[model samples]
Target chain A: MSEHQYPASLTHGLSREEILNRLHNRLDEPRYEHCLRVEATAIELAKRFDQDVDRAGLAGLLHDYGKEIPVETYKRVIIEDGFDPDLLQYGRGVWHGVVGVHFIQTEVGITDKQVLTAIARHTTGDPEMTKLDEIIFVGDFIEPARSLPVEAKARKAAETNLEEASRIELENTLTYLIDARKLVFPKTLLTYNAFLTKE
Target chain B: MSEHQYPASLTHGLSREEILNRLHNRLDEPRYEHCLRVEATAIELAKRFDQDVDRAGLAGLLHDYGKEIPVETYKRVIIEDGFDPDLLQYGRGVWHGVVGVHFIQTEVGITDKQVLTAIARHTTGDPEMTKLDEIIFVGDFIEPARSLPVEAKARKAAETNLEEASRIELENTLTYLIDARKLVFPKTLLTYNAFLTKE
Candidate 1:
């Protein structure tokens, strides 16, 4: 419960409590708790990486805003919003982030482009991630609730170099998706190539 | 050495000995032997599946025709042939199959559409596979020389059902590629979806 407490300064137009309340209304219990952990972790990462802690916290809190939406709604929003047609081939797992942007824009009224981009890319990261983007992405992967073996190394890496940590996290995620025989989104490939081939 | 001997009846247009001589001249020793084993396995599969044995044999023999080509040549051929622009991002590992069809046509003069298609798809299979294509693809994976444990199951499956064997073989290959952190060709995903999600 103490972890749910947010800093007074961490507000993107709406109070932290208001954002959490909105997210709670949309997500189930476990997902809501995960979002809280991601927010705390993203704030910490942002501090270490010299990014805007408030922006990172907001982005993490709302990243999965569209997760609980009905599949039909997601399909409708994707077409109505003019999202890439290729995304239709993938299932709801990949669509939530894409649909989350529109949801946050209309419902949450958080018009910060950086926050919106981070939310849209939280699931399958984009090739060019801002520092805040890296913080939220790495934080989401290494949040305290997650039990991945690489969590310790990733956390340590984030403290010194968030981009390196983000690369490792994306590599591990791509490997896991492949191992599970899941369909890989093309954007995930672009992200992987961008990270690995970076100078 | 005995494996190098092809049945006289297994010739497409060129004599079996002539085809082997041309293949042997172009391929290194191990590659040449692998091609022979694939041809033998393909012929057996073709017989069991009631496909054209000669076409399968020819396809298997020439499947890797572009493998030994210089990387520069592969790149040049890919561009000249107007292959999917996305293919350039992958290395020669994925390009050999795309370039092989052109090579087989001009260099070896094997103009049989079925044989050429089989060769083109031998690396990363197509969504729509003919019986001959399945024979060559499965034969290349479960050839006598391959030490993979799945080889036995695949060969056995091929005896009873070629398409089923192809699905198993493709699944295993995709898993291995993921394990190795290799870049997966898009066609491989299409082929996987085609088989796994077939009605």
Candidate 2:
């Protein structure tokens, strides 16, 4: 509601209220609320992981900035901005992170690379994730509103081992996608493989 | 074994006996035996699927031709022959099929494009596979000696629907790779995603 609600460390040109206004402009009510919950969860995770809490909050809040964009717009931006041509084959489940960074940067006026990269990788994780990235990733999944069965275990794991929580979340996401016959963006698999503990 | 051990229709210049000899020379005894089992399984699948039994048998018999090639050699051939450079990152699990097609063509002297494509796709399947490709793919999984728990279910699926069998096999393979923290070739995920039943 106010500037203090956001992390003081998140000092970009726009106030936290302005960033929320931009998110509200793009996302429907429920999606906007999810972003707030993710922001809260990310701050908690940032504390446990010893990362910048304000940055994590900012990254989480803005992660889904492009979630409501039209498919045609994502396609147009992907082609015009020279994003991977292969990205055209997938939709919002993937584009919101891989392509959404563009929107978060230009629209929200956020310039921090850590926050940007964290948002970019929130949907489909990367082969190597920073501690900040892990916080937003785990926070988004374990945020109180997410009711998936894996959420309980991931939240519990987040209390102790962040990486383990991420592995649980990634595994659950991939399993659901495969079972539902959904098209999986390849980076999800890459992230899954990279996160697995070698046996 | 006698000449009748092979189907009468498999006319690829070299006799089936010569193919067996070549396999024996390159593969360890167990690997060579697996190929024979795959050949038999493929033939049985061919009969069920209304495909040419002899071609399926030949494709199955030679599918793993490059499986035993040294990693160094797989790398060298992948480079020298202008194969997909990405093949260099994966080991025998991938190279044996994608890169092995070249060996089957040159060393084994098998010229059937269908057969070569089947071999090329056996390990990591394509987005669109011919019926012959599906046969070899399922055949190699349901072969009698594969003792993994999923084998029985996959074998049963092969009896009624070869595509279902391939799906089960792909799912099992992917689960194992992810659980074991092994590097999975990207195409394997592509095949798995493409094969899932739409819900």
Candidate 3:
């Protein structure tokens, strides 16, 4: 109910326990481990791209916090958290990201809009990614698990430029989505189109 | 390769076997039976609404003739049959109707543009269905075997007015598609939008 605040880079140097203490029962063990990996990778990739490693790590750590909520609970939270009705069409697997932004605003108590957007679009992906969002998104993909055959090569690409690595990662993910008979989230398509249309 | 030609209705009521003769090897027994039901239903609805009953019946009978082909083969047929690729994303369920129109036009030798369009839009259920197309489209839905609870009421409504009956039928179908998680064919949405906007 308070003004939607997003604390971008909230608790940047906080240890895993410290981060968990703030999020309360919202954190699950396996997902918490994944968040740590995403955060670690984001920092590593940020170093290669000459960006703020701490901010990128912070974005990654919180990107999927909303997903940790149960699916039925996620729907209730989306309504209670206040999101657009069109977002409901995103179905269960992707609805978490939509609700997650609201979670951060209402529950996690963050106030930075850009950081919230990065986490909001972590799953659906946006056409225009802020530098922090791009780093977090790419870092999560190349995180220790998920090990696709080209993971190492893509991770190496991240060193030179996070944007370039993201373009590759997004293309791979889209192709996989098509093969998987999954819904092509419009935001992902828009993001792909965005990059293609960019100078 | 042949010139477009639509099937003509029989002077004597056509038997299922007579209808099957117009189609080639791909027309199976169950589908053929469905076509007969659709044709019969279309004829009855057209008579009640004072539309072109013969055109309605013929279009209904041939609406799905192209469906049994493999997706790759159907995609080729669809593109070659004059469907734009952008309009072809409703999946293979819709591809058949496109191919069926071409079959009617070129192979069967039905040259009437209205009849061709009726066949084309039967599965898709266009918004601005011609007098002929509306009868065929609505008939396919409220046909005798229709198990849906609303079909009987919709069938009776067709007796009062074809266009009004079609509006209800299309809204019902659209709701069903959304509820069932099937993609609403773009043509159907465009048609629905056109009617809503214009009316």
Candidate 4:
């Protein structure tokens, strides 16, 4: 793949076709399909929430770009990027979103801070998420491929009340993590606290 | 109430009768009964875990001493004692444990830091909970009057593995708070993280 296969600009102005082409080469077919669904869901959410649809779509398309990387390579990227050292204690499930930021910046040449923040926090969520952040976060959870029992209610809630939908999704995710005996990254708790207290 | 009704010394050598007398005057009948159940549960856990039964019982008896105080009085105590200002943002559900420490210290004259820390953290756990802290925290949840479905599993786990019991209790509490749309105190998250990463 030539360097031109990726976006040439930092503003994330690439069309959907160009973004898909780049993602297609980087991810296998099934994973690539998930990204497309996430992008479509994110755009719908953005429209409902009055956020910039283009940035949401871009964030969704590129959210899991680092998931395909080798674990050792992701570890190196996490250290080189100067993320919180405590992040090293978690596994790939938590690392992908964080390490994805560095991968997108270096490999995909997408540097929009809002887009980067959305990608960085898409999986676990940050305490202070913007409307765009909520769009991508909720969209990734309720995307078409997801089949959790709560997804239908979450999708409906997303259309009517984004904050409530986000809160429910966070609660569901934290419950799953605890039941599975997996480590929960601290930012997920911070995000839950933020939504729990929101007006 | 007479001054002798409260503990006159810092060592917490007050007899169970004395403690019950003080609690009876301060709390209503049902609340006072709940404290008695907690004390009983705590002593049983302490025996299983090889901790000080007397200290655990004292911590349990005084755990909710501030619960009966008026909300405005607890708020005043919180600020006057220089507790975390962020505590002001949370409602009474989160205040009583924190403000109770000051009331216990000033009114009851019990200055043992371990007992105070256990009382302060009983409602929402601290990250660095000792065996004694775990006894009180789990005991309060699995006490007889508490009939939550998870409490039985938690009680059994407390007898076998205190850490596992504490983790289960925290997960149950956090899930309940989230489902009820209540604000989760940050320390609760810290305790969850600590347990998630423990061996």
Best by DockQ: 4
Docking class of 3: incorrect
Docking quality of model 1: it rates as: incorrect
Assess candidate 2 and give its TM-score to the true structure: 0.79
Q: Judged by lDDT against the true structure, how good is candidate 3?
A: 0.66
CAPRI accuracy category, model 4: medium
1 against 4, candidate with superior DockQ: 4
Q: Write the per-residue lDDT of candidate 1 for residues B74-150, one digit (tens) a residue.
A: 77877887887787787767766767688777766677787888888888899898878888889898888777668
**What is the Cα-based lDDT of residue A82 in candidate 2?**
97
The Cα RMSD across the true interface for model 4 is 1.6
| A96-153: candidate 2 lDDT, tens digit per residue | 9989989887877777888999999999999888889989999999999888778999
- CA error at residue A194 for candidate 2, angstroms: 3.9
Candidate 1 per-residue lDDT over residues A158-197, each given as its tens digit: 7787877877787777666655666677677667667755
lDDT of 4 by residue, B84-167 (tens): 878987876677677787877776667888888888788889888888988988988899777767988887787689988889
lDDT of 4 by residue, A11-88 (tens): 456654666677788899988888888888887888887888777888888898888878898778778878787888
Model 3 misplacement above 4 A: A1-17, B1-199
**Maximum-TM-score candidate:** 4
lDDT of 1: 0.76
Interface RMSD of each: 3.2, 2.1, 12.4, 1.6
> What's each prediction's TM-score?
0.85, 0.79, 0.50, 0.89
How do all the candidates rank in terms of lDDT, highest first? 2, 4, 1, 3
Candidates 1 and 2, the one with greater lDDT = 2
Model 3 clashing-pair count: 15
* TM-score of chain A, every prediction, order shown: 0.90, 0.93, 0.82, 0.90
Residues B1-199 of candidate 3: C-alpha lDDT, one tens digit per residue: 1112233343234454544587646678877677778878777777776777666766777777776767777667757766677645556567666566665565555566766788777777765667787777787787778877678878777777766567667667655654443455556655654554332
